[model samples]
Target chain A: MADTDSSQRVQEILTQATEELKSIKVPNDDQLEYDLGNLLVSNNNTLDETLTRDPEKIDSYLHNLARDSIQALLNRVWELPSERIDSDIYATLPKPTTRLPREKPVPKPRPPTKWEKYAREKGINNRKKDKKVWDDVLKRWVPRFGYRKIAAEKEKNWVKEVPSNADPFEDQFAKAAEMKKENVAKNEFQRLRNIAKNKKIKVPSVGVTGNEYASKNELSMAMHHAKHATASRGKFQPELPNEKKVKGLGKKRKIEFTTGSGQVEKKRNIEVLEKMDKPSLNLDGAIHKEIRDENVAMDLKRKGGKVYGRRSKMGGRHRTKSDHKSLKLGTGFQGKGKGKGKGKGKPKGKPNVGAKKKIGGPKMQGKGRPAGKGKMKGKGKGK
Target chain B: MRPLKNEETVLVFTKLKKYIGSNVRALLERSDGLYCFRLHNGRIYYVKEDIMKFAATLPRDNIVSLGVCFGKITKGGKFLLHITALDFLHPYCQNKIWIKESAEQNFMYGNHVYKSGLSRISENTPKYAGVVVLSSKDIPLGFGVAAKATAECRHADPMDIICFHQADIGEYVRNEEALI
Candidate 1:
């Protein structure tokens, strides 16, 4: 009886020891959610306070935490259905739920050709024909078009019966061949015209406008184009004797100065100055500034706390929720405790006025920086 | 060298289509870069647009060749596919004829493949259809037109011609100057 009682006591001690080991780290039920397919684990619970704050033990604690998460993820993966593939067992992963952004921009749709547009409006449906067609004469299936086509049969005719009024010496086969060539050329010309039309390019002249019928300006343009049409681009063309130079040909007159003395030069200078006086604002610079500011604002929203992790313009003060509110109101520089430690560190080159200086000074400089750095040197005392 | 005129494109494509059939679309539309057909002298070259642009910078007479010379546009307006284009056509050829080992030398010597020489022919190959000639081991030897349909070939006499040889490997040695 004593032996059995001792055995029971030993069993109880062993069970108790195991229980103590299990209780050392309680598994937080809400700690992590696993997507085994993607090998992704999202942790919702905060880091264990004692482990994270303890400087010396932080590294090992974090390592063990990661190991446990991965262990849990692998366990879930093991539960998934597996199949043998090429002598190896593989766990087929599910499609990833995350949607990544496309590397390239979405392709623009092709513009409809004139025929396509017309067909759509008229509700015309195109019916495709078989490539091979029955040839009654040849008594075989022949391609409707292309090499060895049925259309080539006409070119095969050796003998022709001529009319009584027709000349007997005239070659009928040559006429048929010439007619076929003309047809091919006509089709090619039409195809080229359609391509030009679809691409919105100017239709080239088709012998419709000649020197006799064309306007003087049109004739001159044609003449100018013809002169440069030679192999050496008219550079080595032999000049005809007593040939006069065509006006407005070759390079345009480069800023011609009058033969007259001081008066002509003064008039040209005055004209140049007047042209420069016209208000020609660089709108591109303003547009670029606006785009940059929008990007910075987007980054700030995504990061939650900082814009580029730099101190705000209010002299080393971190931007707050109120600062964003004031920024939206165009009073970005006028937040609470506007100028604290720094001595009146107003942005240089831009003075804050009644209401006109509402547009941020940093933005007005094109980049998110104060302009005229000569006056604002040594402004940033290390953080 | 210049871009093929519209009629020339149609002519060249039609000739290429004879061998590749509808698979001609694969040659035209590729993801890598733009490819185009250029007419240099009398020859039609299937070239990449990048190389063609570079070639354009050279004087017209200086460039002897550019890209893969598919064939030449004869003065009579017929586009003849050369043996140089065998590599491109081998994979895409719709009809094929495999010749016997005993006849490989005869084919390479630019002789028409006879009935006894043809070991195998693709089923349903029509007469006069463009076909890639292959060795008994299935390696492309050359290309030609089927002289007899698949059905006709069954009852053809051993002495009869099976495939009319348009181009062969021997042309590389025999007609080397004319090839370019």
Candidate 2:
């Protein structure tokens, strides 16, 4: 026990000293010699038993220990002989990385080009840079279709308002969405952990409360990432899947919105409703009344151009009474009436009473009209 | 090694004197351009230019790099002495730990000596300090890394490979450990 106690004391001193000394000190020469001298004297002087045993021998042992240790250090470091001098200091020193040449090679001058000779003979300076047209857009121009920019402009109109100073996520709803995204990875991990726990998966939970099993990957992932850290440094980039990946999805959503597709879809939906055997009520006051389908009812509501004698902005809405006309050039609005003559129903497929065969009266007949020229009629010599 | 002229080394030696201490200044004062130092029986040293380059990196105004070790301007030459020079001034190096006769063989073989092989340890040794290792017969082994304070290692089991490796051992002849 006593021997163990003394031994323990020695280990600490050694460890502490080595840790301190491992750091480098670069001054040398005489100081190195002095260290060598002192190192020889002080090596075994640090022990408690040595100091207490024999006072005279303590110094002597220290000197011997220091000398030996210093000797070891010098041998390890400098490779110098105790008393002899080596003439080749360069051999002992780190070799110069590059090879030295015997003589410096002279560079040959390039022969003058025709342009340079001409310039020299003409007494004109050639050093000045030629003018460049690279900056001019007319030169080296490429056309851009600007499809994305046009789409962006239309999209910007749809937003109507954007808060300049406030972040979109500063609002509670957006905040909730952002938080959901931030916690998605963790929640997925936790969900797996919970499932494992319920099924009694044999993993030891290293952190947090409860018997939630931690996998090795999860533990390593946690080690790499600090928990609940915020993206406080710069703009928070959401880990959303790329837009190009989900192309045409927004088009499906926009189908119901009263944008370009609304009128076409409404017409198709009206036809489908008409075909359904169980009739639905026309919310637009029609004679036939039945239980209305929700989509059909919405279509009627949208198509109900005049509601309570005022223009309703449901689908094809008119903000002002003067703007109540359809924008398309193909068709005009018609009133509901039975037309006997030319009013409706393809004009009753009417026959003109005075119409005779238009042959000689400002119309050309085969007798009066000459035949159109034909290339291969064989009137000319065959090739 | 060829002794450099006193005029050529005076300024470098002066600057070096500020860092390692006054004995270096005195050693330089009494210098001749004749003999180089002898280390462990006797071996010729290399990379002595490393010392000059290290001194050159220090600021002319103040010795900023006095205690720091910078690798060579071009790499591949890092030596053990660059580190041990500072340890020469380390206060804890007063004590020495002597490896047992059996362990000395292991230590000389480029292996870390176990704490069990420690024949002698100083009482004043502290935790994680630098130390010189010696053979049981009192020949300096080399530098070694202590696992813990001397007092702690005393109570611990002897089977532990407590002394971490630092320098290679070379006494009678130079070995690969002496290459650095």
Leading candidate by TM-score: 1
DockQ of every candidate structure: 0.01, 0.01
Q: What is the C-alpha RMSD of each candidate to the true structure, in Å?
A: 43.8, 39.9
Interface RMSD of the candidates, in order = 24.6, 46.8
For model 1, residues A20-103, the per-residue Cα lDDT tens digits are 663333266246876665678766778888888999899998887776777677666777889752123557677666555875
Error of 2 at A80 (Å): 18
- Worst ten in a row by lDDT for model 2 chain A: A373-382
Best by lDDT: 1
For candidate 1, write residues B20-138 as lDDT tens digits: 97666666655766666678898988766656676776788999987788999999999999988887888999999999999999999999999999999999999999999999999
Q: DockQ for model 1?
A: 0.01
Residue-pair clashes per prediction, in order, are 0, 42
TM-score of 2: 0.23
DockQ-based CAPRI category assigned to the predicted complex of candidate 1:
incorrect
